[model samples]
Target: MVTNGTYERGDLFDPNCGTRLILDRIGDKWTALAVLRLQHGPLRFTELRDGIGSVAPKVLTQTLRRLERDGLLTREVFAEVPPRVVYDLTPMGRSLIGPLTAVSDWAEEHINAITTAQGQYDAGS
Candidate 1:
């Protein structure tokens, strides 16, 4: 726990803290993609799978479950002739969009430079 004049925050850097667990969730590539896809609006399971192409169904399911467990997203199930499920971001998840967008923008902006550096490192190795 963090103690200050008037504010308190979780100690993210602590080895045993939940912060690292949280990071493990959002730091995942699939999680990032899923979050971004849901930013536009809610989508069904198939829609999410199709949008996040090449992801195994099981992996996607696990990712969705993890996000929901963390309270980052909501899963709604509807009863019909055929069962239907949809996923959407929660307020906490929506709050992440801007930061993730900034990260995406930065990656796009620096991709070329990063690739060049990778090439140089690979050549030297």
Candidate 2:
């Protein structure tokens, strides 16, 4: 498809492949946070921005776009005075429950120890 006289490869480990494309979508700074924010229920754009703490508006918009493009979140636009928009997880996104829950529980259980380790590492550095 190019001057290199080569076609695209489908292998994920190829470094220039499409298989890791999914990771590129959801493995960023804000996609997971957006998903976690939407887990409770649907939220407006402003609410989502506030829920995720200090993320900038531009970053949040980009994150939401990536999630929507990947079919993980649904965005609804309402016809109203201010044209409200809401974000919610698709069923596919909800399917992430088990893994997220497991990770959350594990984090809760060992947070103290993790904090101690971080403190030690910080002191060393």
- For candidate 1, the lDDT comes to 0.91
Candidate 2 residue lDDT tens string, 29-63 = 48767887788999999999988899999989988
Q: Where does candidate 2 have its weakest 10-residue lDDT segment?
A: 1-10
Alpha-carbon TM-score of each model against the true structure = 0.89, 0.76
Model 2 accuracy (lDDT, Cα): 0.82
User: Model 2: number of clashes?
Assistant: 0
Candidate 1 residue pairs in clash (backbone atoms < 3 Å): none
Error of 1 at 41 (Å): 0.7
